[model samples]
Structure formats: structure tokens, C-alpha cells
Target: MLSLFLVALASASLLPGGSEVWLARQWCQEPAPLALWAVATAGNTLGSLINVALGRYARHFQGRRWFPASPQGLARGERWYRRFGEWSLLLAWAPVVGDPLTVLAGVFRLAWWRTTLWLLVAKGGRYALVLWLADAWLAPYC
Candidate 1:
């Protein structure tokens, strides 16, 4: 669980780590699958929420223009949010754009609960898929 939390925290930021690798290892070691999934999901969702909070309070720093607090950027994010709604968070597991997407959701002031819920779904699905694939490809060797 601690490792999963670290992986989630790193992956949620602009870092290059992912909880999927840890998940795959845990699965290969024959740990309790459900417990691993739950912990991974919780950690990932919490990390994403931290990013959302950063976006929510970004306006306080006038010099931090790179934080996506500008009016134009916020407007564009709002348009995208309206068009795609909560499902857009499904892409939150994607690399590069994933972390920023969550931040944008906060900058746009979308419903907090909805954003968090969707983010969890997306991230959880991603971890599950990765675990499944690893098991499928590596089980033959084991």
C-alpha cells in the first residue's frame, strides 16, 4: 500500500512513474488482487485530487502564469469540459496530458465530486487493464 501510494503520487505529478508496474509485480507475486487494486485506486485518486487543488488555488500566484490560471485558458478548459463532461476524465490516465487535464478541471471550476469520481474510474480502469495484460502475457512464463 505504501509503495502504491508513492507510485500514485509520482504518476499524478509531471513525473514519469506509474502504479501499473507495481500493480503488475504485485499481481505476479500472487498478492490479494482486490486489496491491491483498491489501494492503488485510492492512492491515484488522492494524487489527482492534489493536482486539482493546485489548480483551484493557482490564481493566488500572479507570477505563476504557467499554472493555467489565465482567463483564456480557463475559458478553453470550460468549453472542453462542457462538451465532454465528466467522461473526459477517462483520458486522465494518459501520459503527458493526464495531469494537466485534472488541473484544468479545477481551473474551470467543474463540480469537484464529479471530477474526482470520473478520475477514479479512469485511473482504476487503466490499472486494471495493465494488470490484466501483464498477467496474460507473463502467466505463460510462470
Candidate 2:
């Protein structure tokens, strides 16, 4: 359980991949889907919070060439933000664009609670859907 949380945490941060794979494996082995879901959701949410904090703090250093946020990436995220408004944070679970959206929300000083709510819905829904699909996929074999 702790491993799942930590793994989900690592994946949730700026790192790639997601907790889904870890989640499905745990579900199949132990069937503790609820506990696993909670851990993964909390860990992933905390990770996004980290990005939010980073974006909030980075307001000062964004223009610096040494900053890790790439210019192109920021530009793209900004465009997305402009197009969708803060609601774009709802897609925070999406790959490629998702991480940047979280940071962008922070950069814009968006309401953290709103972003978090969207994230919870998206991330939690994703886990539930993945679990359902996993069961469906693995059912016939098992």
C-alpha cells in the first residue's frame, strides 16, 4: 500500500507515466480496490499540489533561461489556458499537456480548490475506469 502511494506520488509529480498500472496490479492481487484507490488518488493529488506550489513560486524566475519550464511548453500551456480558461485544469490528468496545465494554473494564480476538485474528479474517474477496464480485460483470462 505504501509502495503504491509512493509510486503514485512519483508518477504524479513532473515525472511521466501514471499510477494506473500499479493500481491494476494491486487490484488483481489483493482486491483492495478501495484502499488502493484512496492512496493513489491522494498521492497523485499531492504531486499536483507540488507542481502548483512550484508554479506559484516560479513566478519570479520564469523568465530566467535556466528555469526548467521550457519556453515552448509554457507558450503552449498558456494558449490552452487562454482557450479554456481555468477550467482547463480539468484535463490535468492528461499526458503531455496535463502537467503543464497544473503549473499554468498555479502561474495564473487560479483558485487551488477548483483545480484540486477537477483533478480529483479526473484522476479518480480515470482510476475507476481503468480498474473496470482492467477487470474486463483480465476477466476472461482469469
In candidate 1, the residue pairs with backbone N, CA or C atoms under 3 Å apart (3 or more residues apart, or in different chains) clash, namely none
Best by lDDT: 2
lDDT of 1 by residue, 1-116 (tens): 77877887778866678678888787777756677888888888888888888877874663574653477765676787788856767888898888888887776677889998
Which 10-residue window in model 2 sums to the lowest lDDT?
81-90
lDDT of each model, Cα atoms only? 0.78, 0.79
lDDT of 2: 0.79
Among these predicted structures, which one has the highest TM-score? 1
Model 1 spans with C-alpha error above 4 angstroms: 62-73
> What TM-score does candidate 2 reach?
0.81
Clashes (backbone N, CA, C under 3 Å), per candidate, total 0, 0
TM-score of each: 0.83, 0.81
